[model samples]
Target: MTKNFNDLVADLSEIEGGYAGHVPPEWLQGRTAYGGLSAGLALAAAQKAMPDLPPLRSAQVAFVGPIAGDIRIAVDPIRRGRTASFIGSDISFEKDGEWPMGLRTTFVCMGERESSIDHVSHDYPDVPPPDIGKATSRGQALSFLQHFEFADIKGNPNQGPADYLRWIRVAERDGLDPMVELMLIGDALPPAAMKLVEGFGPISSITWIANVLTTTPETDDGWWLLRSRSDYARHGASSQVMSVWNTRGEQVLTGMQGVALFL
Candidate 1:
């Protein structure tokens, strides 16, 4: 069954002092929920816990273990200030008669305020339109990929430059919240390291951090730009920088990820 993007967000349940949710296999990346889905759900839980906080400023998450089955998300308010707040969230699950932390995240939220400094260090990349690029099928085998479409602006993933740019968005959840959609689209690109390897094996994102620069609402167009570049790859790990741009050429999010490679 095809699951709506908003439906996944709705699955999260508010509980005493925390949140709870179940991840069906349709959203599974391997034996666990997709990395982005897990992070998004955790963020949703954080939002429920701290409703008055401003837009998301930044989120740092460590994928400590696999997230599977019924999971409990616990959120703690680290500190609350006038313009900003720091919140901590964790995903816990029971397996083999023991419960363990599968993921840990710290989210920073900042409210609107007057600021004298306003500038952007970088501009959106110039790339061909999605129609001119090839649609990526490498991700087709993954169940979660069904929720969205990916078009690679660069050539073949294995033969292209170390950099990649793509146009991606949810196929059905057109009205989805921008921040929630960013979580799903942030990791849409295949690891840039895959271009350096001979063939596909396996790569797992160990840690991910996303910084939100703007909180504009989603537009009717629904497409978001995803650009990723590898910084370095060695010792069975790869690090990369990522950014998400809206159709209006606004840089909505910037992120960094560290991935474990088994290729």
Candidate 2:
């Protein structure tokens, strides 16, 4: 039987080693793999290599090629230290009996470091909750959004813009692993939000980076705020910056993405 969207996402949570591989079904797109799936799998592989370290605080990934067909990924440990650990992994798709499509990622774990100075300089827009009433799932009918609820704060479905605010919370049980939750949320913001902005035309992200500021978000059962904006777009490319906040309003993650927008 085919795996449902939630089932696939749940399976991603448990992927380790090369076992994270998936067979593309007829309904799924064959030209390019979803960035979220690749990112989640890479993060999972990284976490497996550094099981003893603190939960994943952040990850950055670069998509070098299209992962359309069958592929394999190998994870390599770059650095393992007392205070932090770094891991690297790559995905390659099979092409002409050889693997192609390259994707690289770095995972970092921040150990117990305390700082008395607490200062934050970012501010979120005071937008009302996105009309949960108008959220739509795009790309390969079985999108990750089907597993959760999404609300759009800006950009109408009819018109395209570059900025968007979304409220997301898993409908499943509370207390999910921090790294897994981060992987899920981190991958959700990039593509669709970038498409909404007009200047960034038909661009695709070549790389994505996310940094986590708090570790407790995994155990909290609350809404997370994803405020995303495109700062600039030029030469058929653009960059987006996003801030993630827990329901209590504490910033948890910050991310930026560079996209290849086609006009």
Best by lDDT: 1
State every prediction's TM-score relative to the real structure. Answer: 0.89, 0.77
TM-score top scorer: 1
TM-score, model 1 to reference: 0.89
**Which segments of candidate 2 are over 4 A away from where they belong?**
1-20, 23-30, 126-140, 154-161, 170-176, 190-201, 218-222
Candidate 2, residues 56-99: lDDT per residue as tens digits? Answer: 77788897887754666677777888877788777777778887
Candidate 1 clashing pairs, residues 3+ apart or interchain = none
TM-score for candidate 2, residues paired by index:
0.77
Residue 9 accuracy (lDDT) in model 1 = 62
Task: Put down candidate 1 lDDT per residue, 1-263, tens digits, no spaces.
Answer: 55665776677787877977777777788776788888888888887777776788889989999888788899999999887789998998778878699999998888567789988876677554465234533245447787776766654443335677778877776555567777777877778888786777778889999998875545435678888888888899999998888777778899899999887
Task: List lDDT for all candidates, in order.
Answer: 0.78, 0.63
lDDT, model 1: 0.78
